[model samples]
Each structure stands twice: as C-alpha cells, then as structure tokens.
Target: MAILKQDLSFLKNNVKQVDAEMFTSKIRGIMDSHAPQTSRTVTDRTSSPWFSVESKAVKQARRGTERKWNKSGLEIDKQIYLYHKKQVRGINLTAKREYYNLKFSEVQNSKDFFNLSNELLGKDKNTKLPKSIKSELLPDTFGDFFIEKIEKLRHTLVSDFNHDEDFDDSQSDASTLSTLSPVTNDDVKTTILSAVSKHCDLNPMPIYLLKNC
Candidate 1:
C-alpha cells in the first residue's frame, strides 16, 4: 500500500495536475470512507501477542509482576487447588455414618470417644484441613468436636449392650432401656458453644417477629 501511494504521488507531482498535500488528503479520505472496516474488536485483541504479552511486560515493568495473571500469578500448588475445590463444593468435613447417633448415648465410653475423634480427624485430613487442625487437638470450633464426643458415647452404650461377647438378653435389656443423661448432653453443648459461640448461634427474635408481624 505504501509503495503504491509513493508511485501515485510521483506520477501526480511530475504531471503537476494537483496539489500534492490536497490530493493525498483527498485520496486518504476517499479510501477511508469507501474502505470496509478492519476486523478489530476488543475481544479479538484479548489474546493478541501485543496486548497479552507486550502490554503485560510494560505494565510489569512499571508495577511488580502480578501474582494472579500468568504462570507466576497462578502458581498455586495442586493440593491447594484441590482443597479449594472441595471447599467450593461445601465439603467442610467428613464423618462416618453411625457417629451422630453414638455421640448422644448414655453408654458411650472413653474408648469409643477416641475412635470417633480419630475417624473425624482422618476425615478432616481427607478434606485437606490445614495443619492447624492437627496442632490444636480440637478444631477452632467446639460444636463439631463436642457433638462427635457425645455421639461416640451413645455408640459405645449401644455397642456394649448389643455386641458384648458375654451379652445377655437380660443385661442388654437393662442397658438398652437406659435413656441419655440430659445433663451430660447439655454440658457437652455448653462446652462446644463456648468454643464456637461466634460461629454458631440463633436469634429467637426472627421467629417471634415472623409470627407477630
């Protein structure tokens, strides 16, 4: 295009038929008016080498390399990414099937509590809980831990009555007939809420407001 323009200008100037600047301006205007528009759009330039690489380089020269842009920005480890994926899916922690029922029993023993806690901790590890989960013994919140403990007790009680090698129907009937100690359950809940008060609570006013208003 530049070569053609140069050739045209030479011929026009030599013949002295038109003013060079005026003729060039008129030709440019005509070409611009008649020409189909370029296929340039914002989306087209998004992946362009000039914008993606060159412009990024210029920006990085002025600022530091972005921690969220290219390879350097998204340098998250595989474990971290997997952990975040689980979190996005709302898999907060894992637990076994019978854990809940056992925790609420009167006959749940200390051994059962340990087993339940271990299983819950294993699940947390599977969920990619941070090292903080291990170091703290109990997690940051007490509600989950306390509930697990209570459930373990219930399981122990049921197991003792149902699964003992010397299990007698008469003895089993007596043990199984026992009800949960409300005091024990309440104490466990209190301990849990004390630890996780900020994360767990209910405002009773909502129900009252709904009923009245």
Candidate 2:
C-alpha cells in the first residue's frame, strides 16, 4: 500500500512536458515492482467478508504450519497443515452459510426471496452454463435451454410437418386436408418418432428434452 502511495505521488508530481507513453510505462513499472509474479498468490485475509479476527489468526496459524512443513518436509507437519487447511475451509463455509441463512430467513415474500437469493449467489456463481450433460448449470441457463428447445420444437412442428401416409387414396381431398391441418403435439411426436425410426439404434434422449411435447 505504501509502495502504491509512493508510486502515485510520483505520478502526481509528473511534469506537463513528460511524454504520456513514458509516464504510463513508469506507472506500470512501479506497480510491477510491488505486485506478486509467482504462480501462487495469497489474497489479503481482510478482503473476504466472512474473514474475522479469529479467521485471520487461523489463517496465520495455517501459514506457519505450511512454512514449517515446507522446510522440514515431515509427515507430522504435513498432516497438521492438511488439518489446518480443512479447518479453514470449514470455518469459511460455516461462516458463509450462517450469514446467508440468517439474512435469507427473514425473506417473507417471493420478491424478497429472489432478491436475497440473487445477492447470496454472486454474479459469477449465478451465471454459469453447463459445459456437458453431467455438468451443472446456473438456474437461468436451465430455463433458457428449455425455452430454446420449445422454440425449436415450434419451428419443427410448423416447418417439417408432412402429409399423413395413412390418408385414404379414395378421398381426393385427404392429402390436401392433411397438409393444411394445424400441427398438434401428437403429430409432432409421430413425425419425431418416424425420423428416429430410420436410425433404429434408439439412442436414449435427454430427460430435460422429454419434459414437454
């Protein structure tokens, strides 16, 4: 922080004659000197909302254990450090759960519930999409996926619809009537089944896709 202050002070005292590019480069260099370049980065304990005085103490203890384990490479120290890591996870999880539970328990209406729920589930957590079949998605992603499926179904129903083969050849108007008729869910299902029958392997369909017509 002090380094940042000093760097900013230099920027503040910059001359009008200084080249804009050189001034920016100097600021970047100052920042680089103060910032971590290693693969492992440690965030300040005070940055987390759940982090309290006790949390800081626990974190320091864990770090001390980690340092000792790194130096000695003892099995006992390794176990102790692992235990501290587990304890820290539990502390953070419990603190977050209790905090949100308390905050949400007071929600008395649908609007309040959704507001609190959205707040608790941060933007990054709430906007995630499914990468594959087994992967979990954000709540909105599931709804959007289904909505798209329904739209596709609607398009398929209107566009790919064919005249019924079962129509009587005796009736001259049967083919015309079948083509002109409005599409129904049963008709959509029949057309889908017929198309799948050509494949014959009967690949299992996704359960989500089967939720509606």
Candidate 3:
C-alpha cells in the first residue's frame, strides 16, 4: 500500500494523470484482495492465521502503517504550528520547537508518534485557544485527526492560491486567513477517507507501467 502511494506521488509529480489513474485502480484491487481479515472468534487474536503467515510483505506492511501514522502526525503538527505560530510569543516559539523536536526524537527512538501528535493537535484539556489564533487546527477527536488537519490545510492552501491567482486584479493582496473556515470533525473523517480513496486509486500506475517498460 505504501509502495502504491509512493508510485502515485511519482505519477502526480511527473504529470502523468492517465497513468496515475491506472495505478489507483490497481491499488484498489490489491487492497481489496489482500485487505486484512479480522475474526470474530475469541481465540482469533491469539491463534489468527495472520500471526503465523510470516512474509517479507507482511513485515513491510507493518512498517508502512507506522510510517503513515508518523507522516500524518508530522503534517498535522506543521498545520497546528503554522496556524498559531504568529500568535505564539518568542518564548512560545522556542517551547513549541522544542516540543516538536522532542516528539520527533521520540518517534525516531520508539517508532510511536501517534499519541504525542494527538497531544499537540488536540485541545489543551483546559480551554480553547485564545481569539488571537483561529481554532482551525483544533481537532475534536483522536480518530485520524492528524490526517484530517493536513487535508484541511491542503484544501485551504489550494483555495487561497487559486483565489489569489485568478482574481488578483480586483481583490487586494489581503490574506485569506479570515475567510478560512475551521475543519469540523465530520469534515475530517470525510476528507481523510476521500484522500485515501483518491490516493490509493491514483498512486500505482507509474510502477505498473515501469514494470512493463
């Protein structure tokens, strides 16, 4: 799946839209075929067939999940950092950088950045952010919140860039910062699934073609 996504990124970067579509279709097929199967039996966790089916692919798949989580977490942290960086004091900036640096180091050493990412992206456990910074980065839940924020930022940036390029003659060079809307919980889930589908569908064509070539 990670390889499929990487292939998709390559196609996207190379501007091969048609090939990208084919790769995505292939990825969907592969995912559908090899999708993990869960058992309802009480002994399934301990005696599952998957546990014994040792293969290089399985090991890589496990690694891929960790990679995805880390990547998603890092993206969310970047969005949260950017949204509030302006309002953050010099001391806050130093603290924030140190906090993220610590989290990154932890992830490197422990291969677990999920929980820490949640801490940074989630609410303060006391109150919402001050009025100086919009709460666009605040996530309502932990289920894939990191991926959600990244998507929101992606869409917002795309919209802002398009708005600036298309109608710059009429509108002032004002920041679209105020017009930006916060990402809702539902929006996060929806966008995350949408992105997964889109990327999974889009990422495998180049590799498939490269194999043929």
Candidate 4:
C-alpha cells in the first residue's frame, strides 16, 4: 500500500476522484485485511484476566450455594455454602498466583515489574481530581481533605450501630467468637469517635470552610 501510494500519477488521480471518507475507508480496509481486530471491549478488559473458565464455574457454584444458604433454615445448607466458598477461594488464589508468575516471567526490568504490578493491583485512575481544578487554596484546604478521609475511614470501619448485631452474627461461629474483654461494639465506636473529636473538633467548621473557599 505504501509503495502503491508512492506512484505520482496514482496519488494525483486517487485524491482527485476519492472523497475524504472514501479515502479513509480504503486505507482502513487495507489495514484490516492484514490484521485481525484485537481490541477488547470495556467489559472484557475490566474483568480480571486471571479469572479462568474453571474459576468462573466454581464461583457460579459458590453463588448458587450462597443463595441456598440464605434461604434454607438448615445448618447443613450453610455448611454446603461454606464448602463451595472454600473451593472458589482456593481456585481463584491458584489462578491469581499463576497469573502473576506468568507476568513476572515476561518482565525484564523495574519499569516492567511496576507496570505488571499496576495491572494486577489496578491503577487509581478513577480517583483523580478534574484537570480544571487548580485551586490556590489547596495547601490551606488540606485540613478539609484530611478530615474527609478520616470521616470515610470511620464510617467504613464502624458503620451504623443499628446494623452491627446482624453483621456480627453473620461473621461469627461458636469456635470463631472473640475471646477479648466483654467490651460492647458500640462502646468501642464511641471511644474511637471521641478520640477523633478531641483532635478534630477543636477547630471550628467555619475556619476550614473559609480556607477551602
């Protein structure tokens, strides 16, 4: 195609006769005729490459058992779910280890290693600030950003007190119950929030808002 394009008479006639769209399509057709389409769709690329067919089948089975566990009143139903869950976990772990090992074999340097690591761990591309947000108050507003992180951490770890009992029951079995001092969960949350407040609450909200604005 490059050689064909080089003929002076051909180039002059081609441009004179073909519209822009037709010219583009001809070039594209030439390229596609040589190579198969290798691009992945968004959904295909977003899913874990380590997840194999066997792993997917095991995971499907696990989810089936989880539904059974949720609806059935029998302890045996729950036991079956646990068994499937373990099988799924084991298969996924082996798949991921093999995946990383395969990647490790291909890497030749620190840059390659880091790139592969990012592929495995995922990059924080979604968390970036907008490119237009170039605020001069960013330095002084650091306090607000830090406070937001603290609030998110607190909310995620402790959650609401109303849901604690059910969450605890779901996580515990007779053999796995905590053996620590009989401190109530609510009490612990209160202690943590109080400590956060002692340090954070000393500053007035207006001061942070003013700096941020």
Best by TM-score: 4
User: What TM-score would each prediction reach against the true structure?
Assistant: 0.16, 0.36, 0.16, 0.37
Ten residues in a row with the worst lDDT in model 3?
47-56
Could you give candidate 4's per-residue lDDT for residues 104-208 as a string of tens digits? 999899989987788778875355554554677665577788999999989887766547645756655657656777787578656655553332432322232
Q: How many backbone clashes does candidate 2 have?
A: 0
Q: Please give, for residues 117-172, the per-residue lDDT of candidate 2 as tens digits.
A: 77776634355545664455456677898999999999887665554545467856
Error of 2 at 26 (Å): 21
| Candidate 2 ranges beyond 4 A from true positions | 1-46, 124-213
Predicted candidate 3, C-alpha RMSD: 24.8
In candidate 3, what are the lDDT values of residues 109-139, reduced to their tens digit? 3425665666667835455455654466344
RMSD of every candidate to native, in Å, equals 34.9, 26.3, 24.8, 34.5
User: Which lDDT values do the candidates have, in the order given?
Assistant: 0.48, 0.68, 0.54, 0.68
CA displacement after TM-score superposition, residue 53 of candidate 4 (Å): 0.4
Clashing pairs in 3: 8-203, 23-204, 23-205, 24-201, 24-202
Regions of model 1 farther than 4 Å from truth? 1-7, 10-14, 20-64, 67-213
Cα error of candidate 2 at position 162, Å: 79
- Give the lDDT ranking, best first: 4, 2, 3, 1
Off by over 4 Å in 3: 1-88, 108-111, 123-213
